[model samples]
Target: MPLSEHEQRMLEQMERALYAEDPKFATALEGSGLRVHTRRRVYQAVAGFLVGIALLMTGMVAKQILVGVVGFLVMLGCAVLAVTGWRKAGKPGEAQAQPSAGSGSRRQGRRKRSVMNRIEDRWQRRRDEQQ
Candidate 1:
């Protein structure tokens, strides 16, 4: 379920306070972890692709058909991996919203709920401590 208006306002207030207190840390937190992981995957895939090209060249020089076929397969696999990672990385500054009610699987919904519960618990604890 979406946050109520009051909760949204509270969250925004917390975010602004966090930013004001520690801009660097808040900036770091703004980046999605998934984006970082996908970027790393894309980089690795590109490196693998280069290795495949080298293997293909070596096979050509040695006149080994099997080696050349393997290299071609490697390149194809790496290309597919890179493309998928790029797609998943998404646009910079895009908000990573919660999955829609009808979109995600049951397992994902459970996981999201668990995470949110943890966050709520932490928030409650902080509020209690402050009081």
Candidate 2:
């Protein structure tokens, strides 16, 4: 579907507003960069667990549950990192700049599977198999 001319104009206006409100934020998002949440290897998770252990020990000695809780969070984060890596987590392809809902020429191409789509399919398949 193509965006109509009016839609394109509206989209541009919104973009202008965004730039006006936060030029730096808009600019910062303009380039290709490795997303900070990219996945890590299982070993990285192990490293996090180790750090958690040290923190836990300190927390135990100091009688500060907060310290231990933070360590636990680190450990959990590590696990999440490991899982994402194992699953080959990916970022979405560039959001196609369209001219609003009715404006502009519609670009056609293959869209990458979003992370949620991948996860959903996997879970759906697992569920079906168990039935």
Candidate 3:
């Protein structure tokens, strides 16, 4: 159902009250609307999951059992992850990995690459160059 103007105004007033009471909570809630990093990923995952279902259904009807089964499994995995996210309580918006504070926008994926992997990549590049 669509909310009326009065209802939206009331919600806005409530949101202001919430912001005044707890800025953190308000920030979190507001972050939810335009949280490009997290929400977009979740929305993409959900869309991919639904598309997988459609593919599975098409495969099943077309007698392509393997494709159907693969699609179904992929869909099931996404569903399980969506239902149980990283948190058991199913808070999907929260990042599974938090970035370090005050690191600017680079905080999201700042894991240190392993020294071994870096060495291996260097060796591989050298081999490719020689080849």
lDDT of each: 0.85, 0.66, 0.64
**How do the residues 1-131 of candidate 1 rate in per-residue lDDT, one tens digit apiece?**
55744688999999999999999999889868889899999999999999899889889999998888888889999999999999788877887644554566888888877787787877778877999
By TM-score: ranked, best first: 1, 3, 2
lDDT of 3: 0.64
lDDT of 3 at 10: 100
> Which residue ranges in model 3 land beyond 4 Å of their true spot?
1-35, 84-131
lDDT of 2 by residue, 1-131 (tens): 44434556898898899899999998787543433344335567778878988898889899999998998888788777777664453445645343233443333222222343466567767877999
TM accuracy, model 2: 0.35
Residues 1-131 of candidate 3 have per-residue lDDT tens digits of 23434555898899889989999977777554444554455665677689889989989899999989888887887776565442332344563332243355554423333343466567767877999
Q: How many residue pairs clash in each candidate?
A: 0, 5, 0
Cα miss at 59, model 2 (Å)? 0.6
Badly placed stretches (over 4 Å) of model 1 are 1-31, 96-131
* TM-score computed on alpha carbons, candidate 1: 0.51
lDDT of 1: 0.85
Candidate 2 stretches greater than 4 Å from native: 1-40, 89-131
TM-score against truth, every candidate? 0.51, 0.35, 0.37
Clashing pairs in 1: none
